[model samples]
Target: MISRIVRWAAQLVILAGIAAFIGALSVAPAFTYRPADMAFIRINFTHGAPRAECWRPTQAELTKLPPSQRRPNDCPRERPAIVLRFELDGVVLLDESLPPSGLSRDSPSPIYRGFSVAPGPHRLHLAMRDNPRTKEYDYTSDFDVMLSPQQNLVIGFDPRSGGFRIR
Candidate 1:
């Protein structure tokens, strides 16, 4: 009688502990993704330019080819790979060479990345070169930023606006 009651009470405690352990496991990832006292900076953009080696055919060159062989001046559907660089407080953080997107490499390459940093003021340097001919970056931006804990700063490009923008 007394033994039966003790055994049931012990089984109930064990079952409750198992349930609590599973619940904690489910919530652990959520907390890790948004830890306290850290700010995140997001950089995302889609940019590409025509490959420098792809050239337009002159009239003489065009006439020598068949009608099917002759294409428009800008008919090349491929673009050059893009080079990206990011610096924080004069230290290099991210440097990547991204290939163009699309089934045929005709579309703009997209980049989406994030960096975690302590909340404070820092100098940021960003540069990107979509063109392959020149060794210089087509777009460069440098500025000082102040960030708060748990904040997110997003940077992206606007083609119509003709430059990178931050928000």
Candidate 2:
């Protein structure tokens, strides 16, 4: 009876020590994504660039091609690179071009970028040129946003809906 009582007491003490250690860990601040006063900006999108105009085959070219493989107006499957520019407040954040993906270089380009910044009123500028013909940005948007601490801002694009969307 005495040995059993002593074992129970020891087990209770060990359990209490573990509980206190866990409680202390729970009260300590350790893990954090970003600084307490910082905010986040992310731009992610996939877009297909416009292909160049198709060309019709000449008589000589048609004769050279196999009968089953001959095409009158052969269109190009390769697309151009995608141009993107981003400006935050009055400063430029990003300005670069991204090439198309896939083995044939005919697939949509995927882009993802992130930035950490101070929280408050900010001016967001976004622009993209998906067409080879256009000299300037084919799509553009500007917004004034108020960001709180640890807030996340995401920018997206969809050509069918006319481009840039913010969330």
Candidate 3:
């Protein structure tokens, strides 16, 4: 009877070990899992103008405007000479290239585009190019953004008087 009980206990232990091994395998894939709803941010310049030519603004031009006249916070009193296309997740989502020529003081129309995201933790980084005319300036801005599930996100560029603002 003693030998028989010991054998039964050993068998139980082996079965429990197998169950644990299978459970670990099933959970392992979740650790490396990335959601399928990932999206990318893109910029499209209107009229095929080079990014450099379209976004370059002289310091003198920026200084002439009142603080509130700048972009991201204020729509251009005059429509931008250039149009910018913004997209998310590879779709042609926003076409802001042909905005109306005039805007009121309070209308800070967003010039940047945004994308919807699923719930999960995310990271965003800004990428830009400096205009030779204004070494301190970025003529084009790129962003690498990540989002978690059920997260609602909006991303856009504001040419704040030729400076880049991402929100």
- 24-112, model 3: which lDDT tens digit per residue? 89877665333456533333222211222234446677778887654433322332233443434445455443432234322222343
Per-residue CA lDDT of model 1 for 93-152, tens digit only, reads 988889999998878889999999999998889888877888998888887899999999
Q: Positional deviation of 18 in candidate 3, in angstroms? A: 58
User: How many clashing pairs per prediction, in order?
Assistant: 0, 0, 10
Q: For residues 1-167, write the lDDT of model 2, one tens digit per residue.
A: 99999999999999999999999899776777689889999999889888888999999999999999799899989889989999999799999898999999999888999999999999999899988788999999998999998988999998778789988
Cα miss at 148, model 3 (Å)?
Answer: 0.7
lDDT winner between 1 and 3, please give it. Answer: 1
As a whole number from 0 to 100, the lDDT of residue 118 in candidate 2 is 95
TM-score of 2: 0.76
lDDT of candidate 1 at residue 33, scale 0 to 100: 68
Candidate 2, residue 118: Cα displacement in angstroms equals 0.6
lDDT of each: 0.85, 0.91, 0.45
TM-score of each: 0.72, 0.76, 0.30
Question: What is the TM-score ranking, best to worst?
Answer: 2, 1, 3
Local lDDT at 28 for model 3: 77
| Residue 6 Cα positional deviation in candidate 2, in Å, after optimal superposition | 12
